[model samples]
Target: EADIYQTPRYLVIGTGKKITLECSQTMGHDKMYWYQQDPGMELHLIHYSYGVNSTEKGDLSSESTVSRIRTEHFPLTLESARPSHTSQYLCASTKATQETQYFGPGTRLLVL
Candidate 1:
């Protein structure tokens, strides 16, 4: 089993609502990432963090934001939810020296 955990496996909210997607890992990996994917679509890297106090925006443009405080936890937040924001959010982690990434069960969000 993967060490990562995401809360509220599914969510549905009205437009303009605020939501926060939680992602946590117990593997103690220094590298963590957030990916956005639609059903039957390719996953896109949206954000990443190398270690505590380190973060970088990814190739995709996203309204959501992420933070890496403790090595085991990286949470993403959306200040204002919109219909275009509907997607499955996946969290993954890998060791600094290893390329194998362990993914968390995604959080599926729908905006009305």
Candidate 2:
């Protein structure tokens, strides 16, 4: 299954509601990331983790969120949904020695 899973492949919600997108991997990589993008959106790092209990924000990505208590999962939650929150969320990971990342198909979010 490409080692990753994203639920609600597509979502449409009323504005101002809390939302959480799920991401899980089975490869057991130490690095994980979350990104936001538009239809043809460029990847913007929203969140990431280096290892178990080691999470850090990325420069290219926005100020989203991520956690790594379990190496195979990384989920992002928005406190309040907004029209601006409407974008694509993509999850990715790379090996400790390799910088090449693997990406999920993505979750399409629309806040109305």
Candidate 3:
């Protein structure tokens, strides 16, 4: 299993609040992905990276931004949270040569 973790497992915040969802992995995987999903909905890829300092937007258009400063960490930040942003954010990582992605438990955010 991939040693990945997401902090603040559950969060409730007011609208317009800025929040950062933290994700970290100890497996040293070079590639990582971020996905957003609503309850019982499909997962949409919002961001991904091949390695440190290399980030790319995914198929889904998202207001959130991600940074990859170190191989083990990839945090997503929403400058202004809205009700529409209320969803589950998942983090996953995989080795460059591997197709299997190990995912974290995910952070569930609710904007009030």
Estimate, for each residue in 54-94, the C-alpha lDDT of model 1 and write its tens digit.
Answer: 99999999989999889999999999999999999999999
C-alpha-based local distance difference test score of model 1: 0.93
Pairwise lDDT winner, candidates 1 and 2 = 1
Top lDDT model: 3
Candidate 3's residue-wise lDDT over 32-109, tens digit each? 999999977999999999999999999999999999999999999999999999999999999876679999999999
TM-scores for the candidates: 0.96, 0.89, 0.96
Worst lDDT window (10 residues) for model 2? 58-67
Looking at model 1, residue 4 earns an lDDT score of 94
Q: How many backbone clashes does candidate 1 have?
A: 0
Clashing pairs counted in every model: 0, 2, 0
Cα lDDT over the full model 3: 0.96
The true-versus-predicted C-alpha distance at residue 107 of model 3, in Å, is: 0.5
* lDDT of every predicted structure (CA atoms): 0.93, 0.82, 0.96
- Candidate 3 Cα errors over 4 Å, as ranges: none
Winner of 1 and 3 under lDDT: 3
TM-score of 3: 0.96
Q: Say which prediction, candidate 2 or candidate 3, comes out ahead on lDDT.
A: 3
